[model samples]
Target: MNILIKSATLPDGTRADLAIADGVFVESAGSGATVIDADGLQALPGLVDLHTHLREPGFEQSETVLTGSRAAAAGGFTAVFAMANTSPVQDTAGVVEQVWSLGEQHGYVTVRPIGAVTIGLAGERLSEIGAMARSRAAVRVFSDDGKCVHDALLMRRALEYVSTFDGVVAQHAQEPRLTEGAQMNEGPLASELGLAGWPAVAEESIIARDVLLADAVGARLHVCHVSTAGSVEIVRWAKARGIQVTAEVTPHHLLLTEQLASGYDARFKVNPPLRRDEDVAALRAALADGTIDIVATDHAPHPVESKEAAWAEASFGMVGLESALSVVQSAMVDTGLLGWSDVARVLSSAPAAIGRLAGYDTPFAVGAPAHLTLVDPSARSVFSVDHLHGRSVNSPYLGRELPGRVVTTIHRGVPTVLDGVLRDPQEVSRG
Candidate 1:
């Protein structure tokens, strides 16, 4: 299959024609190629997410790899690292391979399974880290998300073990005792709302300890969903000290504040809950200055029953895959904190590098894999459930007007989305 994208604006503010054939970008399109007129569209390397939860093998009512991949495609993503906190937990070679195979079979997006750091995510015994790395899935990232690896010995061991395979240990970074029964960010807002507060120290303290531990062991560590100003300073300090640490900030944490919880809307209720306006400002600055290496959509999806209940009883997650890029564009790009080139780095290149996904961070060049997205930067619309490609409708920005829309997504030279509509898999494969 050959496709030519005409008059497309690159992220660097230059316009050029892009040609793809045999699943790779080429110098020119052969005769009789499919042509797409991309006037007024910004062509970027396909976005990559370092963290996503595609609830499957246990919680299919919420989401699956196929559905989540659709959501990723809708957001202009070509690859996503699926979290390991599923039913059976992606801990073993068999389970990780199954999840990886499902992504290959679906062919919507590249799904790299994140293996659990602990067996059954119990935080007691280590899972088959070496085995998972050696598995067909080639799991390069391990995490015990939804449950922090609180045991210092275990955390250290996990970091040391993965270092042997050039793998990274991604920590959820929440102190269990400090965050027990926590509902929202700890501050005057939680007091005013009469909800339990999740203190910043609960997150910052864990990050502080983990950074020192990572530095001591000379291993790679990644912090997930960094939600506080203090955590940003700590990561900055760690990096200054030459520690091998990387951190990510979620879109919700970047745009929304703890004030949203004032309405008692459970949709705003998330783990490491939204923080103060000052925290949001600090996170945006950190991302701009490179303290935060990537923007990840924790992309958690929950059932209606799980989200429509009392604020305390509702699940601690919001669906984010479909809205990630729009939120970043609205909060970061349009606000002058970042530009299109920076978006490509934060949303694509850096994430691919942190996840060790080879050949993904490469810029658009002849012979590179044809994985890219076309975005309409001028498009603006009030979001609705109709835009959701995943099974879950737990998005926090449901009625908010967000900037930009994904025009087309080409993964491996195959069109998964064209003109903002998801293409049929059968038709795409036959192209």
Candidate 2:
């Protein structure tokens, strides 16, 4: 399908009437192409998610790659890097390549499978990073996400080993000792609620140490789901000292606070947990000034049974794919700290850069891959879990109001979502 995006401005302060033909952006339009009016919408290269949990090849009861890709399209994401924490753990080249094949079979969005840093994410032994890298999947990012790589010597070797292949270690930065049995962020709230205390130092200490280690080994480091003010300081300090480190803040962490734990709702039970309002303020400022490199949804999905259990026994996640773009649009754009271009940068450009997908976040320009999102920034909508395209409905933002709905999503010049509904990817065959 051919696409025509009208009245969109590029981040470099230039405006264009973008045209796509046969899966590539063209300088000029052909007369036979189908055209969609994009008068009030801001068009950008499609969004890329650096962190997502699409539980397939095992946990399909929670989510599959197809369903998660639909959720991603609905959320204005053109591509997503599936995390290594799947049922079989995505540690081997076979598993990683299978995931890449599944993404192709679905063909809704690009799915880059992240290789597990340690076997089964066990942390004691390193996985076949070399084999995974050399596989057809060509996994470029490795992480022990959902579990911190606690051993410093092991982490150093993993970092050094991946450096040979130009890969970065995405750290989940949490000290196991400091967060054992921890339910929420440690402080007044944990005390008042009588929940296990997860102190900020648990996260900050890991980040502080990892950045220094990255500097020592001359390797790149990426921090995932940064949740504390001190962690922000660590990333800032590392960057100032010319260390190669990048950080991402979750949309929920930027918007919500630890006070939500007072309700004892399992929906608010995230891995890092909600933090203080002061930290929220600090995160917002950091994102505004580029201290935070990007905003990742973390987009974890769990079944209803897992979330409906007692607060302490519940799962550690909430679905954010469908709500991410709108929340970022509302919080960042509405506040005037960022514009539509900045939204594309955080949600699309920078994420692709971090994940090392060359064409994933290309601009809507000539010869670029026609991966794009058309968003009506003025559109306001009420959040309803049932309306989300994902199989899971664990979003904490349910019932909340947000602005800027993604009206259309074009992947590889094909309209995967039209008028805010998912199109059958297989129905539209490739040329």
Highest lDDT model number: 1
Tell how far residue 385 is off in model 1, in angstroms: 0.5
Tell me the spans in candidate 1 whose CA falls farther than 4 Å from its real position. Answer: none
TM-score of 1: 0.99
Question: Quick one: best TM-score, which candidate?
Answer: 1
Per-model TM-score versus the true fold = 0.99, 0.97
Assess candidate 2 and give its TM-score to the true structure.
Answer: 0.97
lDDT measured at residue 230 in model 2 versus the true structure, 0 to 100: 91
Model 2 lDDT, residue 250, Cα: 91
Candidate 1: tens digits of C-alpha lDDT, residues 108-185: 889999999999999999999999999989999999999999999999999999999889999999999999999999
